[model samples]
Target: MKSNRFHKQLCAFLVTAACMPQAHADAKKMWVQGSWVNIRQSADMNAKVIDHLSTNTPVFLIAQKDKSCEISWGISGHGYIPCKFLADQVLVFADVATENSSPEKAKNYSPTRAFWIAPSMRGLFNAGKYFQENLLKPEQLNLENGSVQDRPEPQRPPKLIRYSVPEFEAMKEMMNKGVIAPVVAFAPLFSCEQMQEAKRRQVGSSKDEFTRSSNDWSAPDAEKYPYSYIYAHDCLVPEIPKLSLPKIKVSYFKDVQKVLPGNTQIEEISAKFGIVERGSVTGSPRWALDYDTYRYTGAWDIGSYTLTLDKPVYEHVIGRTGLVAVYRWLPGIDEEPFGPSASCEEGLRNQRNGKELLSGYPKVKDALLWFQSATPLSFRTAKINSRAYLAPARSLKEGEEQRGIKKVVVYEVDLDGDGIADFVQWDMWGEPEISGPSPLLTLRQIFININGVWHPFERDSYGECT
Candidate 1:
């Protein structure tokens, strides 16, 4: 009787096991379309999340449901994911093109009224020649016996590559053929911010350092147009003319050199000051093919000067003097601006509550020190340290009261390593408070200890009108 009962139980167990649903033998692989897709335990909206999958994650489709489909979750078991989130193929971002399609394939592309070259074709031509030339070949000198040397090779300025109108039209037409499609369906994988970071990393490093390419296609291709990352991705598309081009020929003043004599030459400043942008002007027969626009931003230290010239004089300067080793007139250390005049001091006195918000934070201390060391003009631009001014709360909308962030408090920071608080700055924003439009209040000031009395020596603010 016992043996018969055991046999009956074994038979029941075998039947239940056989009835259980199993994964399909020929499961098809699908990629996760969106980032951070949830893999749920059951085919329900509120089902427990078993795992998470990121964009382009591969998964095997096991079973199909009404709204969700079961997928093999790693090695342990299967989980259900929404069918809408699964893609039959993976998408390609500009940051991740395994094979770089030739720019020449889009040879029929045309340039807009603002530019001479097809935007799509800018990456194929090297723009780094303007900057990299200074680093590659410095002034070559010929020497013989001591005190006897040949005149140094005349400095060759970086030259811009000129593309004709026909070439521009060809490239534009080629892109229209759909050899390469822009990744506009989703957010840009290689954002301007990412490109800036890549360029920053290449600074001071050798040309070989910048040449190092990643096999990982997901990385941003900063190498293509080292001077301009924007050209690498979006230059293919024509830009809408924002402002009408100047009708007259524009040129930089030769007096620009006279005003700023005794200039200090640097390896590269074009990234900061920028280079002359070349674009074609139609209906103006006087405008030559070699004409270019000059944005003399900080070129003469008299604010930013912009002019569109008929002659290629600016291009000649770039070609002859190279933007990389261009001469700059830097202000002397004594000439650096320090603030907190009587008026500024009077304004800051009304806002100072004398409260310390970030007393023991090491991160804030490190950041302040790093900020001071970042640039030659850091002390002049110390107002950047104030969070209250740089990052103000959004204005409350209609019918919305008690909007978050009521008051911001300023804290004392030790700018120098003297262990004494030398500067007063905004550290953080306040918690949510009763709000209509929150008052924009910010304070940034440095103090000098004179006879044990803290006197405001310098101050900086963005929009503290009072």
Candidate 2:
């Protein structure tokens, strides 16, 4: 079981208080009373760690059982916690306590998303905490989970951004209508298997979207259609217009082109990612972090970029080295990068890491919705079926992950009731790395979805799919 560093005296006192219980009218809101409380997957003491609600953190109540209650403070904070940790009312005014407020957000800290339009999901069954929050009090976290090992100073704490009930309700109403498969825009239905085949080819070519390389886009198709031969192999890269790095020289972009000019720096670069997170491609195979620290969206004060395929072709990276480049994926390529490539078997298995991650964030917040989009290819500027998915914007290739950033997903779905499809959205949020990985966090850029568009719900969301 995950243990806390603080004394259990507070817990004991709360237990005593719980016994003398107040009225059963059931509180409308509950605030975490201790330094922090863990949300569990099951009521059992040893079930699984879900998330932590900081002291004085408040959440709207869903249900109350014996000792634990289901609560969601909003965004990434949703799980079952011991009801004893909360009181009947909000402790602090949220306007003053939230660091995510527009005017209060820290310089280096921004929600991992560029946009967070409220979602329409209120009446939906079990629609996790898409939008929710409460006031909070922050304090240092010892992080002494097990054996005492010195973690470096400057530890990153979680951030809580509160959203208005109206924005959330508005978004919720839109989502209740439903989502449509983006593939509807494409001519042929591209299966996930076909998408995987395209990716395997990119690795074999040792070329990615950013890397300088070329490919034969022509492919044989089982059933030919008007757009059957819409071969694609390129997309709009970071080019020069999108970079907003810091002054520090990113090894990858140290002497590159306009992408990573001579001297570049991000206001704040995580000790993690090292080069992967840099706007410039500065990664070498041996030098890069293992399969875990795959680069997610990098959103700083300058604002984040939409990591999407410019057109209809799926995006792929030639993961041969750290300087990864996006690839215009062509299904049925039947090839892999010649040198430094992973077996298709390993690659396919890696995608499932998303499942493992959700269980890690055991509250199962913002599960997932994947589909194929008719993306445009840079090479021919032709549309083709591209594999795409909308997952929570956050990811965790490391542990002790900082929390609070919410991922926003603007998508189109056909409301079953409406018949014809229309565009609707939800500000997706969740984190897998909050508790880190069980066993131990590993090194590897485990691909859950393509880097740009499909992001985790919350920052640092990771889990062991194994």
lDDT of each: 0.31, 0.28
Q: What is the lDDT of candidate 2?
A: 0.28
TM-score of each: 0.21, 0.17
Q: Which stretches of candidate 2 lie over 4 Å from their true place?
A: 1-151, 154-159, 177-347, 350-466
Tens-digit lDDT track for model 2 on 292-358? Answer: 2212111111011111111222232212111112222321111111112222331112231112121
Could you tell me which 10 consecutive residues in candidate 2 have the lowest summed lDDT?
112-121
lDDT of 1 at 83: 93
- Top TM-score: which candidate number? 1
lDDT of 1 by residue, 1-466 (tens): 3333222222211235432224458888776664345678899979998655544555678878898988873334478899998878863332222123356522322112101111222221211112222222343211100122123432222232222333223323332221211222112224323433454454424544433332222224543322232222111101111211112111211121111101111101111122222222121111111112211111011121121212111100111111111111221111101111323232223221111222222112113211111012111112222222222335668986533224334444432333444334332232213222544333333333332333323333333323
In model 1, which runs have C-alpha deviations exceeding 4 angstroms? 1-24, 95-466
Model 1 earns a TM-score of 0.21
